[model samples]
Target: MDSHKILSLLGLALRGNHLAVGEEPVEAAARAKDARLLLLASDAADNTRRRTVHFSEAGQCLWLRLPFTKAELGRAVGRTSAALVAVTDIGLANAVANRLAQLDEDQYGEAAERLALKAKRAAERQSELRAHEKNVRTGKYRPKPRRTPEDSSPQVEKSPPDRRPRNQNRSRPRRGSPTRSPHPYAHSRPVKKGKGSFRKRED
Candidate 1:
């Protein structure tokens, strides 16, 4: 069937629980070997596409390529870039196959040709998923490293030297008059103002 019709059929099959999603053509091909049906994106690489075709031919699995981009396929399958989806359950497989057959008959006169195309696409998707998985496992798909404690540690600033205390810097008061003078009236003698005799009243 055409990519669009195939995608529609695959989309319906995905609602069932028998499908395995893959990001690489190899993985998709592997999944397809045990699956009743496989779905692939139309825009997968040529090498992946050829491998998928070979896989389908060797395994006798039904495969189809949707007319969507990898990104579109990913979005449809709730992933970033899904290459393949395999239907594993026998009942689900039969149901999807029957539906796909009907869609192929209705949409394209060459049901056999459409089926072949579908198989090719499924293989491609599987291969893509396998490659992607390999890259991730090998650390080729390395993510940004997170910050460690050393990277985020707080810096401590050194304090300045302290000055001397006020008592240590104090000096004696300046001298002007007598430094230890006594009371101002200490040597003064009292005289009677209205005394008649020259002798002092010593009583």
Candidate 2:
């Protein structure tokens, strides 16, 4: 039998607080229906074995006799001696039973298979719960309003900007420059006849 693996799992369960050692605690867990599996040491007393059966019935869970003695089981759970142990978590129960079934399929096969299915379903439920919580935290639980084609506003085509030459648009020159008349003769002064006139006036 793979005794080391079973003991290791027990130690893990103990560390996680999923295991209840001793008669009183096991019986309490069984009565509360929190025990997933009950483990009985191979060297347990007849009376202890009988009570384990009763506890299993009360908890509606499976009970298995481990190949390890009370001392070995006890050390696995950090106790001086332990004859009975109640596993509260389904996953741990499944792991321990699966390792046992690998050692002796004829004895632990059915329980392992049942616990495996239960653990799988429990894991799926936990995953779905986490996803739901994430959606709630990120505000994705509410449906967003979608805009349809009919609800969209019409697009207006914009006219292109003027690209014509800028000089063609200027009709006047800049300020501070001399002005020219339309005809040179229009603004010419008449020649005066008083002094040294070179030009004569017609009558």
Looking at model 2, report the run of 10 residues with the lowest lDDT sum: 191-200
Distance from true location, Cα of 145 in model 2, Å? 18
TM-score of each: 0.39, 0.66
Q: Distance from true position, residue 44, model 2, in Å?
A: 1.3
- Candidate 2 steric clashes: 0
Which candidate's lDDT is highest? 2
- Runs in model 1 with CA error above 4 Å? 1-16, 23-33, 90-203
Candidate 1 similarity to native, TM-score = 0.39
Tens digits of per-residue lDDT for model 1 on 142-173?
77799999779987787987688867665454
Model 2 lDDT per residue over 1-203, tens place: 47898999999999999999999999999999999999999999999999999999998999999989999999999989999999999999999999999998999999999999989999999999999999989998976799998569797788999898899776576688777677879967786657664567789
Q: How much is the lDDT of residue 177 in candidate 1?
A: 43
How well does candidate 1 score on lDDT at residue 97?
49
